[model samples]
Target: MVHNFNSGPSVLPKEVFEEASRAVLDFNGTGLSILEIGHRTSLFQAVIDEAIQTTRELMKLDSDHEVLFLHGGASTQFFQIPMNLLAEGSTAAYLDCGTWGKKAIKEAKLYGNVEVVASSKDRNYTYIPKGYNIPSNATYFHYTTNNTIEGTQMHSIPETSVPLVADMSSDILSYEMDFNRFALIYAGAQKNMGAAGVNLVVVKKDILGKAGRPLPTMMDYREHIANGSLLNTPPVFAIYVAMLTLRWLKQQGGVSVIEKINDRKAQLLYDTLDSLPVFHPTVAKEDRSKMNVVWVMDDPDLEKEFLAICKDNGMVGIKGHRSVGGFRASLYNALPLESVELLTSLMKEFALKKLNRICLRLFLSRHCGLLLSLPAR
Candidate 1:
């Protein structure tokens, strides 16, 4: 009954958990634990194959795109991407939407010239910036589709003929979109996809080997893709768990169906927040994220009390990030609507209780004053 709202390493399906647990003890009736399986063995190969295939199917990717499960998380791609695509003299355009985007811009600068096309930092990244022109000669235009920390999302793809690159770590596969438009897309599996220790990268085949810079074999996306993401010992257990999660996604009728459910969950929670005066959503209405919903209490002092109530009621990881202190509720694909419902109900109850206490205080102050004036009682 514990409701997990963690932004990363977030909730996953119950059935996926059960299957993964079983695999840990006995993988597909093989006596060896999934952890003990050889990475080069046919068994492990099949797992990776299915994982990649499921990802392709879910995203409706074509043969031109190559899927890879690499060693480092998405943060590694912040530099690896530039190493593989942004040549020494070339410039890459970036959209600074939030923390991750800013980090990406910093990393890209190390490889080549980086032009910040637009940024929402002026307003603390509460909304996505618009109408910025991408440089015509830029190698690629990069952006983070969803800002988990800021709780804002870019609803539409930027109109750019320059190759599109995106860090979709927080929102990948959470909703349906034109997956093929991006030349490269990378996501840390911890958020909506699966466990930690693995990062998913999907790159169009034609985009590789164009940077004209020497890259370490490990840092080269082409090397990883060429070997089918087996350039080295892969994260066997994490990949297996991610495979199970992808299967679970397929069983739930694919992204299109789940996107609707995600929408409904977000709408219900947003409605509850809007109806309550005590709670205030931080991001712009149009830019509010469907995955991570960030908000604050009108009275900052009430935050701790509300968080305490949530913890007492079995809600975990409801506190927001340290940098942006308030509250963040991540509604991942695996999180049930019932959890959101319970949270909204608790918010309403808390707000009503606060109102009742205020009314009682006001009444007591007036009555006490009247009595004191009338008599020395």
Candidate 2:
């Protein structure tokens, strides 16, 4: 069996895949394929409603928080968030964890006074930046929950009366979160949810209509929420697939249970990496990510060789990001521990051989030294 560990558009539950496979051909009570169904049809409306309801249920959100599924990607929200929330004079305090956080900070700067409260760039983003003072009057504190490229994560949120907004594109639904504390939480539905066409935006109702700016119809969170996220045609298939994934998550004892399993998987991989003398984990221990584990061998060349061996052994998507080159094994919710076990076994074997070779070379060097230094008797 094969395991897919790609960071984005990553592994999905097999049960979700099986159900989605059938829905592609024939949807509920309708002969038309799910892809062919009219977005306005009652059948599709039910699908949309169930998805929104399930999302609310999963997050345990209140009436204050309304979930909206939109067509623009999460990157779109990089701008829309500031446009819809912050005004010309207001500032948003941002924490730069990695690539996505930097992008969010960059985009928000175009709309308002963006204060970079803290950043991990000085340290190569190996650890999450914490303890920076957020301006009490700041519009909100924006952060990315997990850094897929750098393999760093914010394990717990900073306490703030000021609103907290997160770009959870890579970590959403993989674990539990305090929905009440967030003013906004948005994720692109490709990684843990479904396909790439749709972005899920969940916003607290109290946070809207405060920006007081004229937002474009497509860019307005209020507009989408007002129209039930159906102002225009939506990515019907993507939402449907996401709904199936959510259903599967529910069946597997919900996020609380899945989190336990995810913790176990991450521990297994990290422990194996630490135990192998040749492998060095890149992410800092305190800020290590559960989703992405980045590491390298004593020799960069050997790391490349190890990746090639993994690919030949039926593993895919283990290569690290180009900017942070080495090895990154993404253990999204669907990646089984068996795949991790296989990778660990290979690492152990390779490390043993390396140690043996070192031992043999040292023995020869000492023997040569004795022969050269010995006096004629």
Best by TM-score: 1
lDDT of model 2 at position 126? 92
Per-residue lDDT of model 1, residues 1-377, tens digit only = 79999998999899988998998899999988999999999999999999999999999998899999998999999999999999998899999999999999999999999999898888989999988899999999999999999999989999879999999999999999999999999999998889999999999989888888888999988788879999999999999989998999999999998999999999999999999888999998999999999999766679988999999999998999987889999998989999999999999999898888766666767887632222210
Off by over 4 Å in 1: 364-377
lDDT of 2 by residue, 291-328 (tens): 99998766777887788788888888898899988889
TM-score of each: 0.96, 0.95
Evaluated at residue 60, the lDDT of candidate 2 is 93
The clash count of every prediction, one per candidate, is 0, 0
